[model samples]
Target: MTAVQRLRSAAVLSPPLLWTVVFMFVPYSILLVYSFWKTQYPIFVPAFQLGNYMELVRDPQYLRVLLRTLKIAGLVSFFALVLAYPYAYFLVFKVKRPSVRLTLYMAVVAPLWVSYLLRAYTWKTILGTQGVLNSFLVSTGILSEPSSIFLYNQAAMVLTLTYVFIPFMVMPIYAALEKIPPSLKEASADLGENRLATFLKVTLPLSMTGIVAGFTMTFCLAFGDFIAPFLVGGPDGVMIANVIASQFGAALNWPLGSALAVVMLVIVLGIISASDRFERLGAGRLT
Candidate 1:
């Protein structure tokens, strides 16, 4: 309201506001321009036509790949949530030793510090024909030969992504689970509610926020990932991001790539918006 107060408020907000405009808004504008341009002959014309988007809609290959990416991301998010929920519940309610529990959580999240590329390549060695698992199986007389089932496939891609993103899922769920008051569980028990009933009515409802956050984070990462698919997905694991990369690389169609990116962006933003709406509704209902 006063000059001094206004100046102080402006000083506080300026850095983050400037950073968002410069780093986020500016880059998106450039990408938006590229998405509308045409790449034909030896020239990139500013045609302002929706031909690039039209091709993506009409072309079955692009549609299929887009659907495949969505499916894989959905599965990755689902599996990550399922795996994380129990571990988070254990940490929240079961673990009594604070030091041990903290150490265990740290160990699970330690892989986040490692290089993503290195993580992807680690799977390569483990899944190779004469890799560790194969060699062990052969030595144990469980298999006569090194099986080709482990490497360069959809299974490998999904598994690798899930492993890499598991921490993201766990951390959010843990944060959510931590918020649930212990007294709520005790109160439920005092009401003669069974463990299962109390959990369903109290713990799970309170932790729904974490599930939504984890799913959103995991799905976004898995959906946009190109490197994981490239290293592990031989043929079947190729997602929309891989197709988008090909357009810029061997496909040599920057316009098409930009178009695909725009489509992906739209879908992701739509998901976020939908999630936000659901979150608000859920919160309102809880209140």
Candidate 2:
């Protein structure tokens, strides 16, 4: 390429490249450096060490919390996929009217207009002992009084995360389903394949890209979430993020917090890598 072409390319990339360096790369680099340092009470000592990471490995409580965090994240992703896929399929295949499809899509995305904190707190209210569900059950004689069964548990955390992230799953799957050519199904039928066979072979394979995208997105978000757990995930329901928050907050242990953050980033990146492979495989099948 010509020097002018190179110059033009550099100019076009400069803004985003500078922004990433200043905001993302620099901050992450600082965190990475901090993760190897020691914290002396409120002061951060500049000495390089592996004590923070070593502590993470040595502490059974930290390992348990990490496991619980992964479990909750996996459950949230699975439930979100289960709930979102069918709705997306219905919107793409069953709904005939474009206007109705648009309306339904809007409804699915409408919750994003509200603040996430507000939504999390709203679930807290709905699941509380004296909340709407309990009140309804009591009034209908399903129970003699309001029950504490609904709130402050892993189940409550799962429910709230699933509700919050369902739309993330829905939109991607819908986009993939919408892109599928109607003629492909017709061709399969003309070739003497049954609907179920055609769907399993063609429809599902094509939609895997979106499924992988949605699942990865939801998993990462739910894994990093601290708010839902903080609001409704009582003693038994707390995840690793809560512990990480405490390390950075009241504990004032920056090194430990940075190490934990790095570990989470590594896991999230690994998941994304696997998802990318799945996406590539799906694309290859389509081609």
Candidate 3:
């Protein structure tokens, strides 16, 4: 490449690289420093300490919360994947008009543009005692009284998060399914295989990449979600993020929160690594 071309390339890349170093790397470094700082009687002091990490190691509450967060994340991922597959298939294979397909896809993803707080709040209102759902049920004689069934519970949190995050799951799977050539399915049918069998042997195997991608995306979002749980989840529905938020905000223990944050980061990275390895293994088997 010419010097002018190299200069152009460097100019294009420099802004983003500089932004990442300033915004992401610098904040992370500060967070690491904060993680080791000691909390004084009324304020956090400059003294370094390992007590925060040691406390995390000894606390069963943190362990339980971490486990619960994982469970909820697993459930969210599972539900999102299972639900997204059919919708993705429809959009890719069943939808005929290109314009219509684009419109439908946008509809599925439009929720992302809405405020996250508003979405959670909407669910909270829908599930609340005097909310529209309860009013409708009572008027229709489905229930004589407004039951405390939905508001501020694990189920509510899961439902809200799943709804909020389904688009992430759908996009990847849709891309995967859409990339699959139609001739492959025709060939499978020509070989006397039924539709289900063809999908199982051909389409499904090829779509593994999207499944892995969707699962990773959903798990990461759900795992780090605090607002959903905070708004709709009562005490029992609290996740690791909520605990982390409390440590930083109400508890005023930045060190403990930072330690927990580090732990969460490790867990997310571990899951991603395992998923990538599994995806590679699956690809190897197919070949």
Identify the candidate with maximal lDDT: 2
- Alpha-carbon local distance difference test for all models: 0.87, 0.92, 0.89
Tens-digit lDDT track of model 3 for 1-287: 99999999999999999999999888878787888887887968765888888998798999898889998998999999989999999999999999999999999899999988888899888989998889989999999999789788888888899999999999989998898889988998998999999889988988888899899999999999998878989888889998989999998988888888888888898989998997887762332
Candidate 3 deviant stretches above 4 angstroms: 1-9, 283-287
Clash count (model 3, backbone only)? 0
Sort by lDDT, best first: 2, 3, 1
The pairs that clash in candidate 2 are: none
The estimated TM-scores of all candidates read 0.95, 0.97, 0.92
**Candidate 2 deviant stretches above 4 angstroms:** 284-287
- Least lDDT summed over 10 consecutive residues: which range in candidate 3? 278-287
Stretch of 10 with least lDDT, candidate 2 = 278-287
lDDT of 2 by residue, 1-287 (tens): 99999999999999999999999999999989989989896567987899999999998989999999999999999999999999999999999999999999989899988889999999999999999999999999999989998999999999999999889999999999999999999999999999899989889999999999999999999999999888989889878788889988888898999999999889999999999987987772842
Count clashes in each candidate, considering only residues at least 3 apart in sequence or on different chains. 0, 0, 0
- Candidate 1 residues 37-116, lDDT tens each? 88886747777988898999898999999899999999889889888889988987789999978987997799999999
